[model samples]
Structure formats: structure tokens, C-alpha cells
Target: MDWIQGFLVFLSGICALLFLFRKFFFKSKLANKKGCDHNCDCH
Candidate 1:
């Protein structure tokens, strides 16, 4: 029972960290100009 509780706490910490990372670092739009397409010259 103690081990299970510890595992759950660790999992919760990892989930919280992932959520914060995504919230701060995830971008919703592309920064590059000219857009994305097979014919686009931008790399």
C-alpha cells in the first residue's frame, strides 16, 4: 500500500511537469513564412 501511494505521487508529479512544459513551450502556429506545402521553397 505504501509503495502504491508513492508510485501514484510520482506519476502525478510527472503529469504536472508535462502539463507545464506543454503549456509554456507548445506553439499553435508555424513561425516560418511562405506556409507549408510541397512546392514551398522554405525549408
Candidate 2:
């Protein structure tokens, strides 16, 4: 039971780190790009 709780804590930490990295790095990159790949006339 103790080991199971520890494993869950470790997984949560990893997920938090990944979420922060994506928020800071990937979101900015997408905003700076000057193109739209989605449907509709964005140009």
C-alpha cells in the first residue's frame, strides 16, 4: 500500500513538470508562427 502511494506521487510530479514545459515553450512557439493550418480562410 505504501509503495502504491509513492508511485502515484512520482507520476504526478512528472506530469506537472511536463505541463509547465509545454505552457512556457510550446504555447509561445505556436503564437509566434504566422500561419493557420485549420479549415477556413485565415490568410
Q: Evaluated with TM-score, which candidate comes out highest?
A: 2
Worst 10 residues of 1 by lDDT: 25-34
- What is every candidate's alpha-carbon RMSD to the true fold? 6.8, 5.3
Candidate 1 residue-wise lDDT, 1-43, digit = tens:
9999999999999999999888644332332443655654445
- CA-lDDT, candidates in order: 0.68, 0.74
lDDT string for model 2 (1-43, tens) is: 9999999999999999999998877655665573545632333
| Candidate 2 global lDDT | 0.74
All candidates' TM-scores?
0.60, 0.61
Q: Which stretches of candidate 2 lie above 4 Å from their native place?
A: 30-43
- Model 1: lDDT to the true structure: 0.68
Give per-candidate clash totals: 0, 0
TM-score of candidate 1 relative to the true fold: 0.60
The true-structure Cα RMSD of candidate 1 reads 6.8
